[model samples]
Target: MRILQIHNFYKQAGGEDTVFEQEAQLLRAHGHTVEQLTFSNNDVTSTKAKLQAALGVVYNPQSAGIISQSIKRFKPDVVHVHNFFPLVSPGVFWVCRKYKVPVVMTLHNYRLLCPSAVLYYDGRVQLENVQQTFPIKPILQGVYRGSKIETASVVLATGVHKLLGTWREKVSKFIALTPGAADLFQNSSLRLRPEQLSIKPNFTADPGLGAATREAYFLYLGRLTEEKGIRTLLKAHSIKPFPLKIIGTGPLQALVEEYAAKNPLVEYLGFRPREEAMEQLKRARALIFPSEWLETFGMTAVEAFATGTPVIASNIGGGAYIVQHQQNGLHFSPADAQELASQVGLLEQLPDLAKKLGQHARQSYEQHYTPEANYARLLQIYGQAIGATEKPASATVAAEAGL
Candidate 1:
C-alpha cells in the first residue's frame, strides 16, 4: 500500500516526532510504499512569522494546497497525519476530502480538546476545558505556552473546526493510543463517534530481556518536567532514600541537579543515547513512571517492559492503563509521595516478587508492544479507513470549504 504521512514537528523533538518516524519505518520495513511531508516549528522564528502562524492556526490554505499537490502526484492509498497543530492546521483534512482520499489521524495528544494538549498546566491536570466548546478558561489563563495570545489561537482553531464538524466528518478514522485516551476524547467536546475512534497503543522494538541479576537502584526515564511527576519522584525519594537513577533533561534540570547533589543515593544522568538508556533499564530493579497528567501513552514504561523490568507507575492516565498493579507491575496514587515510597520499599524488600513482576512485564511486552503485533493492528486500521464509505455531512463540508 502507498501511504502519505504528514507531521508538524515541534522546535524540540519529542515522542510524537519519534513515533511518526518509527511508524513510517515500520510500514516501509513491511514492504509498504511511504512518503512524508513534514513542517517544523523551528521555522516559526521571527515576530512576523509567529503572527502569520497564529493567523493560520485555524486553517492554512498554503498547507492545504501542498497536500492537494502531493495527493495528486503521489496517489497514495491513504493519508496518515500524526500532528498538524499551529502549522498544517485542519485544512489538510478538507484537502483530502476534496481529492476523495481517506485520512487517518493519530491522536498523539489532546490538542483538539485542550489548549495545552496534555490536559495539564499550572502545576496540575486542568480539565476545565475538556467539556467547553470555546475553552474560555484555558484561554483566559493562558494555559498554552504561558501566553494568552498563543492559547487563544489554539482554542480558536480547535473551536472553529469543532463548530464546522471538521473533526467528526473530514477524517476517516482517529487512532487513540490507549483505551483511556479513547474514552477521554469520546467524552470531550470533540464528541467523536465510537466508530470513528480506534485504540492502538504505541510499540517499540524489543530490546531483549535484561540480565538475571538486577541492579539495586530504581530507574526514572523521561523528561524532567513537573507534569512528568519529577517533583513527586524526588519527594518520594526524600521520604525513603533509595538508590535512584534519573535519565532525561527538561525545564526542571536544575532542581534534579540540586537533589542529586544533596542525596547520596540519587544519581542524575543527563540525557543519554537510546542504547545506554536501554542498558540502564535492563539492569534496574524497576522503572518508576510518576507522570501526573493524562499521558496519551507511556513509551518509556513500555520500553522498560521490553527490557524485562517491571514498572511502578502512578495510578493515573496511561500509567494506570499500561501497568497492571501487582501483576506485571505496581501502581500508586498519583502525586502521593508516601505511597510511591512505600511501593519502592516493597520492591526492595521482596526481591522474588520483583523478579516475578519483571518476568510478567517481559511477557506483556511480547504480547502487546512488539513490532509484529503493532504492524497487524496498523494494517487493520488502514484497511478500515480505506473501506469507509460514509459520505461526509454536506453542510460540514461546505462550511470547511468556505474557510
Candidate 2:
C-alpha cells in the first residue's frame, strides 16, 4: 500500500515531528510505500519571511498548492496528515479531498480548538478567554513579548476553523492520543463521525542509547517554558530534600537560571544533544514532567519509559495518560510546588517503591509503546484505512463494467 504523510514542522522540533518520523519508519519497515510531503517553518529567518509565516498563521496559498501537487504526484491510498499549523493550513487537507483520498489527521495538540495550542494562557490553563472570577483578559494580553497581532491570529484562526467546519470536512479520521482528548471534542459541538475518532498514542524509537540506569538526582527534560510548570519544579527543588537537575531550553531559561543561582539542590544543564538527553534520562532517579496544560502526549515521559525510568508527571489532561498515578509512575498537582515536593520526597524515602515503579514503567513501554508493538499497531490502522478506500474503488470500477 502507498501512503502519503503530510506535515508542517514548527520552528523547533517537537513531539509531532517525532510521531511523523516514527510512523513513516514503521510503515516502511512493514514494507508499505510511504512518501512524506513536509514543509518547514524554520527557514523563515528574515523579517519578511517571518511576516509571510505570520500571514500563513491564518492561511498559505503556496503551501496549499504544494500539498495539492504532492497528492497528484503520490496518488496514495491514505494521506496521514500529522501537523498543518501556521504554515500548511487545514487547506492542505482539501488537496487530498480533491483527489478523493482518505485523510487521517492526528490532533497532536489542541491547535484546532484552542489558540495557545496547549490551552494555557497567562500562567494558568485558561478554559476560556476571560477569567471566571476576576474577568481578566489573559487571552488578549499575550504571554511573551506581547504581540497582539500574533495572539489575535492564533485565537481567530482557531475560532474561524471550528466555525467554518474545517476539521469536520477535511478529516476522514481524527486520531487522538488518549480517550480523554477524544472525549473533550465529543462533549463539545465539535463533531467527527463516531467511529472516525480513535485514540492512538505516540510510539518509542529503538534508542541506540539503550536502557537508563537509576541515579541519585531526578531529571527534568523538555522545554523550560512557564506552562511546563518550570517555576513550580524549581520551587519544589528548593524545598525538596533530594537534588534535581534540569535539561532543555526555552523562554523561561532566565527564570530557571535565576532559581538555579539561589538554590544548591537544582542543577541547570541547559540544552543537550538527544544522545546526551537520553543518557541523562537513563541515569536519573526519575523524569519530572510538571506541565500545567493538556499536553497531547508526554513524549519525554515515554522516552524515559524506554529507559526504564519512572516519571513523576502532572495529573492533568494528557500528562495523566502517561503516568498512571503510582502504578507505573507517580503524579503531582500541575503547578503545586508543595505537592510535587511531597511526591519527590516519597520517591527519595522509598527506593523499593521507585524501583518497582521503574520496572512497571519499562514493562508498560515494552507492552504498548515499543517500536515493534507500535509497528504492528501502525500496520493494522494502515490496513484498515487503505482497505476501506480500496473497496469503494474496486466496486465502482466493477459496476462501471456491469460485472
Candidate 3:
C-alpha cells in the first residue's frame, strides 16, 4: 500500500512528532510505500509571519495546492494526518475530499476540542471549553499561549469548521489514543459519531527487560512542566524523602535545580538521550508519572513498562487508563502529594510487590504496546477507512459555505 502522512511540527519536537515518524517507519518496514509532508512552527517566528499564520489558521490555499500536487503525483492509497493546526489547517481535508481519498487523522491531542490542545492551562486541567460551542471562556482567559488574540484565532478556526460540518463529514476516520480519549471526544462539542472514532494507543519499541537488581531511586522522565505535576512530585518527595532522579528539561527547570540543590534525596539529571533515559528506566525501582492533565497517551510510562519497570501514575486521564492499579503498576490520586508519597513508600517497603508489578508491566507491554500489535491494528483501521464510501466533491457547497 502507498500512504501519504502529513504533519505540522511545533517549534519544539514532541510525542506527536515522534509517533508520526515511528508509524511511518513502521509502515515502510512492513513493505508499504510511505511519503511525508511537514510544516514547522520555526518558520512562524517573526511578527508578520505570526500574523499571517493566525489569519490562515482556518484555511491555507498554499497548503491545499501542495497537497493536491502530492496527491496527483503519489496516488497514495490513503492520506494519514497527524497534526494540522496553524499552517496546514482543515482545508486539506476538503482537498482530499475533492480527490476522493480516505483521510485518517490521529487525535494526538485535543486541538479540535480545546485550543490549548491538552485540556489544561493555568496550572490545572481546564475543561471549561470542552462543551462550549465557541469556548468563550478560554478565549477570554487567553488559554492558548497566554495570548487572547492567538486563542481567539484557534477558536475561530475550529468554530468555523465545526459550523461547516468539516469534522463530521469530511474525514474518513479519527484515531483516539485511548478509550477514555475516545469517550471525551465523543461527548465534546465536536460530537463525533461512534463509528468515526477508533481507539489506538501509541506503541514503543521494546528496550528489553531491565536488570534483576533495581536501583534505590524512583524515576521521573518527562518535561518538567506544572501540568506534568512536577510540583506535586516535589511535594511528595518532601512528604516522604526517597531517592528521586528526574530526567528532562522544561519551563520548571530552575525550580527543579533549586529543589535538587536543597534536597539530598533528589537528583536532577537534565535532558539525556533516549538510550540513557531507557537505561535509567531499566534500573529504577519504578517510574513516577504524576501528570495533572488529561494526557492523550503517556509514552514515557509505556517505555517504562517495556523496560520491565512498573509505573506509579496519577489516577486520571491516560495514566489511569494505562496503569492497572496493584496489577501492572500502582495509581495515586491526581495532585495528591500525601498519597503519592505513600505509594512511593509502599514500593520501597514491599520489594516483592514491586517485583510482581514489574513482571506484569513487561507482560502488558508485550500484549498491548508492541510494534507487531500496533501494525495489525493500523492495517485494520486503514482497511476500514478504505472500505467506507467516499463523499463526492461539492464545489457549490464549498463556495456557498466559504470553507
Candidate 4:
C-alpha cells in the first residue's frame, strides 16, 4: 500500500508528532511505501509572519493548495492526516475531496471542537468549557488575552470551522487514541461514523524496559507545566511516607525546585533521556500522573503501564481512561495533595497489593497496548476505509487517476 502521511506540527514537539513519526516508521518497516509531508508553525519568521500564521490557523487556502499538489504528486491510496492547526487547516481534507481520494484522520486532540485545545481557563481546566453553553467562551478569551478583538479573531478561526461543517467533509474514518476520547467525540456534534471510528492508543519504542522488576519509589514523568500539576505532586511529596522522583522540566521548574528544597521526600532529578526515564518507570513503585487539565491522552501513563508499573493518576481528564480505578491502578482527585499523599502512602503499606496492581497493569499493556496489536487494528481500519471488503485489496490495480 502507498501511504501519504500529513502533519502540521506545533512549535513544541509533542506526543502527536512522536506518534506520527512512529506510525510512519511502522508502515515503512512493514514494507508499505510511505511518503511524508510536514508543515511546521516554526516557519513564521517575524511579527507580520506570526500574524499571518495566526490567521492561517483559522483557515489557510495556501495550505490547501500545497496539500492538493502533494496528493496529485504522490497518488497515494489514501491520505492520513495527523494535525492541522495554526496552519494547514481542515482544508487538506477538502483538498482530498477534490481528488475523490479517501481520507483517514486521527483525532490527536480536541482542536476541532475546542479553540484552546486544552480546554483551560485562568491557568486551570475550565470544566464548564467542555460543554460550552454560550458566546461567553469568546467573551472570556477576549478578556483573557487583554483585548476583545485579538481573542475574538482567534476564536472566530476555530468557530468558523465548526460552523461550516469542515470537520465532517468527505472523511472516511476517524482514529481516536482512547475509547474515552471516542466516547466524547460520539457525544459531540462533530461525531464520526460509529463503524468507521477506531481506537488505537499511542505506543512507546520497544527497548524492553518493562521487563525489569519494579522497586519502591513513585515516579512523575512529563512536562512540569501548570496543567501537569507538578506543584500539587511536590506538595504531596511532603506528606508522603513513600519517596516521589520527579523527571522532566518545563516552565514550572523553579517552582518545583523551591518546593523540593523544603520537602525532603521530593527528589527533583531534572530531565532525563527517554531510555533513562523508561528505566526509572521500570524500577518505580508506580508512576504518578497528577494532571490538572483534560489531557487528550496521558502518554506517560501508558509508558508506566508498559514498564509493569501501575500508575497512580488523577481520576480526571484523559489520565482517567488509561489508569482504571482499582483494577490496573489507583486514582486520586487532580491537584489534591492529601488524596495523592494518601494513595502513594497506601502503596508502601500494601506492598503485595501494589505488586498485584502493577502486574495487572502490565497485563493490560500486553492485552491492549502493544505495537503489533495496534498495527493489526490499524490495518483493519485502513482496509475498511478504502472500501476493501476483506483484509487486502484482493487485486493490484492502479486507480483511475493518481491521488
Candidate 5:
C-alpha cells in the first residue's frame, strides 16, 4: 500500500508525534511505500508569521494547493493525518476530497470537540463546549495559551469546519485512540457518525520486562501541569507514605521543586532522556498517574506495562481503560489525594499483589500493545477507508454509463 502521512507538530513533542513516527515506520518496515508532509508550530515564531497563521488557521489556500499537488503526484491509497491544528488546518481534508483520495485522521486529542484540545479547564473536565455551536467559552476564558485572540483562531477553525461538513464528509474515517475518546465525540454535538469512527489504542515497542521484584521507589512520568493532577500528586506525597520520583518539567516546576525540598521521600529528577526514563520504568515498583483530565490515551501507562511495571492511575478517561483495576493495575478516584495516598499504602502492604499485577500488565502489553498487533489493525482500518472511498467512485462511473 502507498501511504501519504500528514502532520503538524506541536511546540513541545508529545505522544501524538511519537505515534505518527511509529506507525509510519511500522508501515515502511512492512514494505509499504510511505511519504510524509509535515509542518511545525515552532515555525510560527515571528509576529508576521503568527498573524498569517491566525488568518489561515480556519482554511489555508497555500496548504491546500501543496496537499493537492502531493495527492496528484503520489496517488496514495490512503492519506493518514496525525494532527492539523493551527498550521495545517482542516483544509487538507478538503484537498483529499478534491483529489478523490481516502483520508484517515487519528483523534489524538479532543481538538475537534474543544478549543483547548484537551477537554480540561480550571483543573477539571470542561464539557461546556460539547453543546455550544460556537466555542466562545474557551475563547472568552483564554483557554488556548491564555490569549483570547489565539483561542479564537482554533474556535473559528473548528466552527467553520463544522459548517462546511469537513469532518462529517470530507474525511473518510476517524481513528479514536480509545473507546472512551470515541464515546466522548459520539455523545457530543458533533456530526460524526458511528460508522465513521474506529477505536485504536496507541502502542509502544516492548522494553523487556523487569525483575520480579522492583526497587523501593514508585514513579511519576509526565508534564507537571495542573490538569495532570500535579498539585494533587504533591498533596498525596506530603504524607510521605512511599518514595516517589518525578520525571518531567512543566509550568509547575517551582511547586514540584519546593515539595521535593520539604519532603525527604519525594524526589524530582527533572526531564530525563527517553532511554533513561525507560530504564527507570524497568526499575520502579509502579507508575503513578494522577491525571484529572480524560487523557486521549496514556502512553506512559502503556510504557509501564511494557516494562512489567503496574500502573496506579486515576479511574477516569483513557487511564481507566488502560489500567484495569485489580487485573493489570489499580485505580483511584480522579483527583482525591487521600484515595491516591491510600492506593500507595495498599501497594506497600500487598507487595505480592503488586508483583502479580506487574506480571499481568506485561501479559496485557504482549496481547494488545505489541507492534505486530497494532500493524495488523492499522492495515485493516486503511483497507476500510480505501474501500469506502472506491465504492462511491465505482457508483459514479456506473451512473455515467447508465448501467
Candidate 6:
C-alpha cells in the first residue's frame, strides 16, 4: 500500500508525534510505501505570525493546495492524517475529497469536539461541553491557553468544518485510540456512526522483559501536569510506605521538587531518555497512572506493560479499560489520593500478587499492543478506507477542473 501520512507536530513533541512516526515506520517495515506532509507549530512566532496562524487555523488554502498537488504526484492508495490542528487545518480534508482519495483520520485527541483538545477544563474532564453542539462554555471561560481568542479560533474552525460536513463526508473513516474514545465520538453531537469509527491503540517497540527481581519504588512516567493528577500523587506521599520516582517535567515541576525536598519517599528524576525511562519501568513494582482527564490513550501505561510492569491507574477514561483491576493491574478512583495510596499498600503487602499482575501485563502487551498485531489491524483499516463505496464522482470532477 502507498500511504500519504499527514501530521502537524506540536511545538513540544508528544506521544501523538511519536505514534505518527512509529506507525509510518511500521508500515514501511511491512513493505508499504509511506510519504509525509508535515507541519510544525514552532513556526508560529511574533504578533503578526500568531494572528495569521490563528486565521489559518480556521482554513489554510496553502495547505489545501499542497495536499491537492501531493495527491496528483504521489497517487497514494490511502491518505492517513494523524493531526491537522493549528498548522494544517481541515482544509486538507476538502482537498482529499476533491482528489477522490480515501482519508483515514486518527482521533489522537478530542480536537474535533473540544477546543481545548484534551476534553478537559477547570481542572476536570469536560464531558458537559462535549455533549453540547457548540462548545460555548470553553470559549467563554477561555479554556485553550486561558485565552478566549485562542479558544474561539479553535471553536470557530471546528464549527465551520462541522457545518460543511467535513467529518461526515470528506473523511472515509475515523480511528479512535480506544473503544472509550470511539464511544465518545459516537455519543457526541458530531454523531459519527458506528461504521464510521474504528478503534486502534498506540503500540510501543517491545523493550523485552525485566528481571524477575523488581525494585522497591513505584514509577510515574509522564508529564507532571495538573490533569495528570500530579497534585493527587503528591498528596498521597503523606502516607507513603514505599518510594516513588517521577520521571518527567511540566508545570508541576517545582511542586514535585518542593515535595521531594521535604519528603524522603519521593524522588523527582526529571526528564530522562526513552532507554532510561524503559529501564526504570522494567524494574519498578508498578506504574502509577493517576490522570484525571479522559485520556485518548495513555502510551506510558502500554510502555510499562511492554516492560513487564503492571499499572495502577485511575478507574476512569480509556486507561481504565487497559488496566483490568486485580488481573493485569489495579484501578483507583480518579484524583483520590487515599485510594491510590491504599492500592500501593496492597501491592507492597502481596509481592506474589504484584509479580503475577506484572506477568499478566506482559502477556497483555504481547496479545494486544505488539507491532505484529498493530500492522495487521492498520492494513485492515486502510483496506476499509480504500473500499469505501460512498465516495461521489462530483468530488473527483471538482478536482479535475481545479474547483
Q: Report lDDT (CA) for all predictions.
A: 0.90, 0.76, 0.90, 0.75, 0.87, 0.86
Q: Which stretches of candidate 1 lie over 4 Å from their true place?
A: 390-403
Model 1 CA lDDT for position 204: 96
Candidates by lDDT, descending order: 1, 3, 5, 6, 2, 4
As a whole number from 0 to 100, the lDDT of residue 43 in candidate 4 is: 91
Candidate 5 local accuracy as lDDT? 0.87
Q: Residue 331 in candidate 6 has what lDDT?
A: 95
The runs of at least 3 residues in candidate 2 whose Cα sits more than 4 Å from the true structure, single-residue gaps closed, are: 45-59, 129-139, 143-145, 208-213, 386-403
Stronger candidate by TM-score (5 vs 6): 5
Q: Which of the predicted structures, 4 or 5, would earn the higher lDDT when compared with the native?
A: 5
lDDT of 4 by residue, 31-94 (tens): 9999999999789779987777667766687888888888889898888899877677777777
Pick out the ten consecutive residues of candidate 2 with the lowest summed lDDT. Answer: 129-138
lDDT of 6 at 242: 70
- Give the TM-scores of the predictions, in the order they appear: 0.96, 0.88, 0.96, 0.88, 0.96, 0.95
Write candidate 1's Cα lDDT for 1-403 as tens digits: 9999999999888999989999999999999999999999999999998888888999998788888999999999999999998789999999998888989999999999988888887888887778888988888888788999999999899999999999988888899998888888889888776667888899998888998989899999999888999999999999899999999999999999999999999999999999999999999999999999999999999999998899999999999999999989999999999999999999999999999999999999999999999999898888777767345334433322211
User: What lDDT score goes with residue 72 in model 5?
Assistant: 91
Cα RMSDs, all models: 4.4, 5.6, 4.9, 5.2, 4.3, 4.8
TM-score of 3: 0.96
Mind sharing the TM-score for model 1? 0.96
Q: What local lDDT score does residue 68 receive in model 4, on the 0 to 100 scale?
A: 83
